[model samples]
Target: MEKTYLRAVEVDQWQTRQDITVTIPDSFDREVMASLPSLPDEPEKAVEWSGMLEMIGNASGVLWQKDAEVESLKTQIEIQKKAMLDECQGLQAELKEARDETHRANAAAALATNRAIKAEAWLQQVKEALASGFAPHLGRAPVERPSVLLAR
Candidate 1:
């Protein structure tokens, strides 16, 4: 059967390379490498498609390497996605805690403001009572005092 894939090259022909190294699970760094036949090296014999059939097996080997690289990339993507999800969850929890703390602080400030208003009202009432008590005697004569009570 003819191959569905085209030629795979050394270090792969993919223009974009991965920034992170991916080690596929269950693959302990074992791989196969092969070079396909090219133009005549010595120029002694001219052979075209006659012997190109032998390179089919080599092509399949290279194809496996490409497949492994693709699989590794997929695994890395999944891992990064999961990590981002976890970080988001943690940030959400922190945000919730900060909101709760803000609410509590606002409540405390309101309570303190109400208490200050009540204290100020009490102080004003005391001042009014003192002023009124002293004002009644402003125009009255001084009351006579007994000699016995003033002697001490």
Candidate 2:
């Protein structure tokens, strides 16, 4: 049997691990490798490493919770955006209906105006024929009696 000495040293800026150099009999090397110590012997380094691993776990948990919240908020935002788009489409349809109604009303108004103009023209022609004492030169048939005389 041979004696082995292992030392723990800090690695990088934030980590500590064992640094060991050993010469052992071939038969004992396999046993030594199988039963190597997992933790540093120094109490302060062990405590620090344990606390750091715990902090990392806590931070990872917080990050996962925050990610879940972010996803929930994104889903809510998508729902709101869809609702707003539906509302906008509805409003657009309503506006188009109103515009179509206005166009129909305008067309009806134009027709009525044209009819009124034609009525006025016809009335003026009739008045002129009466004032001219039933002129035969007009396109109408000659009247044998005046309209007023016939009315009486």
Question: What RMSD, rounded to one decimal, does every model reach?
Answer: 14.8, 14.5
Residues 115-143, model 1: lDDT tens digits: 87777767766666666666667964444
Clashing pairs in 1: none
Query: Backbone clashes in each candidate structure, one number apiece?
Result: 0, 0
Q: Which regions of candidate 2 are displaced past 4 Å?
A: 1-44, 47-49, 132-152
- Candidate 2 C-alpha lDDT tens digits along 68-141: 68979999999999999999999999999999999999999999988877777677667757857656566666
Superposition error at 28 for model 2 (Å)? 30
Error of 2 at 10 (Å): 37
State each model's CA lDDT, in order.
0.60, 0.65
TM-score of each: 0.51, 0.53
Cα error of candidate 1 at position 72, Å: 1.5
**Lowest summed-lDDT stretch of 10 residues in model 1?**
25-34
